[model samples]
Target: MQIETGVSLKPYNTFGLPAVAQTLVRIEADADVRRVLGDATLGRAPKFVLGGGSNIVLTRDVSQLVLKVEVPGRRVVDERADAWIVEAGGGENWHDFVTWTLDQGLPGLENLALIPGTVGASPVQNIGAYGVELKDRFDTLDAVDLITGRSVRLDASMCRFGYRDSIFKQALAGKSLITRVRFRLPKPWQPVLGYLDLERKMAETGQHQPTARQVYDWICEIRRAKLPDWTVMGNAGSFFKNPVVTEDQCRDIIGRDPEIVHYPMPDGTYKLAAGWLIDACGWKGKSIGRAGVYEKQALVLINRGGAIGAEVVTLARAIQESVYGRFGIRLEPEPLVI
Candidate 1:
């Protein structure tokens, strides 16, 4: 375990928000986590597990011990007639891992291409895009308990994955650190192209029967066109989760606003586009202090150069209030505000 003190976390987090970690420990393996837990001085202190820093907003200097996951490795763990089981270190770059799987002739992860963050953070957020969520492809994960330092393997059901959430974000939040994750990529790989953007790509390119690589390229293209590069501009991809509502609630809102963008779910509910709601509320390109909504996509909040966490929070709160007032639906933020 490599330890540092008074570390400036701006470079670590994608938001580029100013914050200092009083104590930061780089955990490269399960043993590294155990070592930190075994340390007399560090063991008892409150801890925060950090992955790629893609899905978080650091609102202030973190006083608790920060464990930066840096575990590394990826491989085809098992192969069978029905599926291919792939495993990756928690610290592995999510998008890079997805690309690697495709390079190795594994195709299931293609639709998740270009998503920012580490593999460990994937299950925590139950990250999804283009109609595919991490839970759909997940097999099992190994995590070490924060208090006991004992490693445990958990299955998909144990994770209790829901829309953009999982056990990691709930009962296991900050209580354990994921070291590795495995995915079951099924055989006869079928492409998931039901999302509107993928459909549009198919129509535009006349490649309805695209391969896995084609789907990966298409997903990358779609995301790049919509979301800002975190390196160039400090921001999380999406600031709010698309709110799902009952059929009656959706119909009630649709009656007043016929142009609202919504998708019917298998459960007979509706997933209203959070970006559309924000844009309709006149928040697109709007700013509060140094934090501003991305002009191209209302779903994103950008740090307009030297913006602090408070500014982002202030801006987000204002947008949330406006969206709730207009739609009668509360927009939940996707990022973990620290």
Candidate 2:
């Protein structure tokens, strides 16, 4: 564990805000992880675990030690007749993991390519893109409790997966740092043709069903074109979780705005397309100070340059208020705010 005092977290976070960490520890090796956690000194509680820094925004300087996981390793745990068990260090870049699976002739993760984050943080949000989510392939994760310094394994069921939520993201929020993640991949996959853009892209390309690699490439292209690169600009990925509504609520939104898009939920509910709602509310290109909704995707809030976290949160609230005022639906943030 390499410890640095009073570290500026601008580069660590995708938001590019100048929040400072009271203590920043970058753990690379397994021993390094144990050393940091088991150390008697630097007795910081309520630590913040930062991965690729995409799915989070620090509203203010983190008042505790920030443990930025950097342990990197990848391996195939087992290969059965149809499935492959893939394990990665918590800190491995998520896109690279997808790329690795594709290279290994794995198929299920194709629809989720190019999502920016580390492997450990994926399960916390149960991250989804196009039509695939981490929960679909998530096997388990190893996390350590901050209070007890105890390690534990949480299986898929124990995770309590939901739309952009899990136990880790909620009850254990900012209190556990995941050290490893395991995912089940398929050598022979059940292809997901659920996303409209992907289905249309497949049709436009004159192929009924492209290969897993092809789907991966297409989705990456779509995401690249749709989202602003945080590396070039700055953002914490999609800032708001698409609001889920009841069946009756859906009817109301549809009655008011027939063009409202919705996806049916298994629980007899409906999820309003947040992008559609924001676009309908005319917030696509709205900008306030350095924080602004991405011009292309209304759901994605961007940090155009140097921006403050509070200002960004304010802009997000404004949009949330706008959508709520019009549709009677409340939007919740997807990112972990500190």
Candidate 3:
């Protein structure tokens, strides 16, 4: 409930970038929500919602109100024979939520293991990994309408999920604040290992149909091996989204670079692996000043110790130019830069 001015954001963000928020408010409860936003003295101002601070790039000091969503709780409101409906507060840490669900023997969320972010922001970006996305198990969500100053609950259909996107990031955009999320999880089990990493791990382990917990552990291992930890080394995960291209464009890209890995969509279009394209473009592991690309994964840009936000943005732009020039595909940044 404490509101501070010009607070140092080095601890809040994983990248360790020292960006300052003009006014930072941490709302611990639902009551605190209106109390902070309705303050007459603060007046109307630009604001950014910060969660676990993953999936974002703090490129510069934000001269606006930064409302750090901290409203937190959970409830096993409904239970069935096959699956259970578990609800979590918006401020609940994403990994903690996953761990708690796993301990409860809940299925479905095992594939989302170790993803660093807040539960409130999950639906906003429709976070995904391996072969699963949040939308796959989405039941419903409750959010506060920023304009109406009222709470609302939306179902899976209303979310309009698509390739790491949702109504929150599209139609709803910045007009609402997610207060709670409900997930329909299976009680029994079903481990999806269709992805290359899981499949490869299964082969190495000489086992098939591993338990949900096992899948979680394996995924955590795989992610740690490729993605750098933001605590020690600075990074915002994958910097660019995989470009979904037309069939002809895909062919043109593949014709020149046959080694380009692609995922074919059900809609007939193809998604070019952004990491492969960036790595192939000779930008992978390449550093300019302090900001540079991660060596293991080409899609991630790292802040090597003291990299400035402007420098990071510049490097990202450079990568975009490279990818666009090489494949005629414009790469889009995944981070919500403020």
TM-scores for every predicted model: 0.99, 0.96, 0.95
Task: Please give the RMSD of candidate 2 to the true structure.
Answer: 1.5
Best by TM-score: 1
**Residue-wise lDDT of candidate 3 within 243-317, one digit each (tens)?**
899999889888899899998888999988999989888998898889999989998899898987778888999
Q: Count the backbone clashes (under 3 Å) in each candidate.
A: 0, 0, 0
Model 2 stretches with alpha carbons more than 4 Å out: none
Cα lDDT listed for each candidate: 0.95, 0.84, 0.84
Q: For model 2, what is the alpha-carbon lDDT of residue 326? A: 89
What is candidate 2's lDDT per residue for 1-338, written digit by digit as tens?
78998998888888888788888899775566567767777554557788888877888888877889987889888888977888998899999989998897767888888888898888988999877889898888888776666778999999999889999877887777788898988657777877888888878998776888888888888989888888888987778888888888889879989988899988999877888888888999888888988889988999878889888988988998998898888899888777
Instruction: Name the weakest run of 10 consecutive residues (lDDT summed) in model 3.
Output: 40-49
Q: Once superposed on the true structure, which residue ranges of model 1 sit more than 4 Å away at CA? A: none
* Model 3 / residue 319 / CA error / Å: 0.6
User: Residue 157 deviation, candidate 1, in Å?
Assistant: 0.7
Which residue pairs come into collision in candidate 1?
none
RMSD of each: 0.7, 1.5, 1.6
